[model samples]
Target: MIERKKYMSLLEKWRDKKVIKVVTGVRRCGKSSLLRMFREKLSDNGVEERQILEFNFEDLSNEPFLDYHVLYSHIRKNLCGDRMNYIFFDEIQMVENFQKVVDSLFLLDNVDLYVTGSNAYLLSGEIATLLTGRYVEIKLFPFSFAEYIEALPDGTPHDTAYRHFSEKGGFPYTVQIANDDEMLREYLTGLYNTIVLKDVVARRKITDVMMLESIVRFLADNIGNLSVIKRISDAMTSQGRKVSVHTVENYISALSDSYIFYPVYRYDAKGKQLLKTGQKYYLVDTGLRNIINGTKGGDLGHILENIVFLELARRGGEIYVGKVDNAEIDFIVIKGEAREYYQISLSVRDENTMQRELAPLQAIQDYYPKYLLTLDNDPVVLHNGIKQMYVIDWLLQN
Candidate 1:
């Protein structure tokens, strides 16, 4: 297994601090596996098995502990006096009033707590309010391009590995079946359905399942394009399926909360403000997008853009679809005082196409770094002071 060094380093930095470590991500993104791996790390570092207590609320046998009192009592009994204790709760959202248990345990001086949840709701509850400034969040994503490459067969060429990664996406389960296209499609489809039905519809008490599916289709069909609720509603209406704008808004929020789709707002780079209208939505994984909507075959342009967007996000960039005057930059990444602008395309082979991609970055007056990423094997060179990079090369560099 490839070690998730990025997340592990974050956990190590905050190890044994006076804060709860909350790990959250979409379902099947390996939250449970990460907690297990960390637990093993603890054991290897001389932490006794008895000092570390782990609970997976998803197991039916753990149902009795879903009550806060029961959970609190169980862990309190397990506490051997004196030494620090590590507590891990997987899918803690299954527990009723779970925040109470966490908040209560946190009062103890000898306890270090960790939890994994499937949605943002876990962090927005009364527990978050109580623990304000006392917790750190580690948002996890599916395998990245670098992680994906680690699983490739020995001696696979870079282009072949990239095509597989781009086509099958970076989900761990999909990687196991990377060579089998048919099975990967079926697996992703099942995973997507479970996320929608269990995570979104069931949790949100949504009654219009069909409408939700329609919206999912619409969003997947138009990834990385400017969108709004009214536009979504109108598109559904034109297709003979009527949906209200308010309903569309709620559905979109549900999708976002479930971590299946990510919404990127448009930023007015020239004005230095976020634009209120015309946002873009990208899926959590391109393979899932391909299974649901055949996005990979139809528009490699947007697929490349979506891949770049997720990579930027994985590197912890404050990302936005950038708008400068009449020109649009694919992404604007701001980290502290440093800003980087990116324009992504299939290739910058044509002079006109390169000029089009370069115009927006050139229009910006700031001296922040600018890049134009593409699939061409063009030598890395400066065109009008903007750096050009091969997208695959840039992804692996992270």
Candidate 2:
């Protein structure tokens, strides 16, 4: 397994702390793997096996312990000594009213708890009220380009590695079948269906499964395009499927809550405020997008943009699409007092394309590292202090 140092470092910091460590992401994004890796680390560090109690609710063996009382009793009965007992629960959302069990276990003096879930419901709604400020969320993603490269066999050429990484995406399972296109596609399709059927449709009790699929396809086809619920409703109605704007809104929320698609709101760069109407949605992983929407040659620009969007999020930046005057910037990332502007494209090889990509950043008067990233081969153009970089180089470096 690739060492997910970023997430492991976070878990190490929160080790034995009073707060619950809540790991969240979409299905099969490697939450359980990370927890298992952390368990191995703890054992290597002299923590005894008996001191750690781990349960995955998805496992058939754990079905008997799904009841809150049974789970609580199991943990309570297994307390080995006065030393801290680390409890790792995978897919805690599978258990109904799990917050009560967690709340009850939290009262124990010897327990240091960690839980993983596929949806935000574990932290929002009623659970939020129950665990108010008592949990720290560690959001996990499939794999960063850096981590993806590390997972591959040693000494693979960077170009070949990058092509495979972008095409196959960072899902760990995909790495196992990277060389087999048909097998990888089948795996991704099955994974996508599970997320839709189990995470969104079944969980929300959405009756219109066809409508949900339509909305997902629309978002995948129009990645990074400004979207509104009414517009989506109208589009679906035109296709002989009538869906209310309200229903569209609810479905969109459900998709986002499942971590299938992320919504990035527009920000007025000059006004320093978020614009509500022209919000854009990006997929959590481009591999799923490509599989669901059918791989298209024309969508490379959007694919690169999606990759950059996920990279920004993984780097802990608060990202927004920027509108500066009549021009739009692809990304405006604000992390702490550091702000960076980015415009992503397939290439700025042509004169008109170069100016179009640079216009928005040139219009901005700030000096906070504006970048125009593309696929150009190191043709450095330093226009008014804005640095133009090759996208692959930037991804590998940062």
Q: lDDT winner among the candidates?
A: 2
Per-residue lDDT of model 2, residues 95-133, tens digit only: 998999899888878889999999988888888998987
Q: Lowest-lDDT window of 10 residues in candidate 1?
A: 289-298
On residues 1-398, what C-alpha lDDT tens digit does candidate 1 reach at each position? 77898988888888799999999999988888888888889889999988999899889998999888999999999996888899999989888888888888888999999999987788875767887988998989999888888877778877788777777888888888877888988899899999999889998899989989989988988988898889999999999989899999989998998889999999999899999899999988888878887743768888888888888888986899999998899999989878899999898888899889888999999988999999897679897779998888898995
| Alpha-carbon shift of residue 28 in model 1 (angstroms) | 1.0
Q: What shift in Å separates residue 264 of candidate 2 from its native position after superposition?
A: 0.4
Residue pairs in steric clash, candidate 2?
none
For candidate 2, what's the RMSD? 1.4
Best candidate (score: TM-score):
1
lDDT of 1 at 140: 93
lDDT of 2 at 293: 77
Which parts of model 1 have CA positions greater than 4 angstroms off?
A: none
Worst 10 residues of 2 by lDDT: 290-299
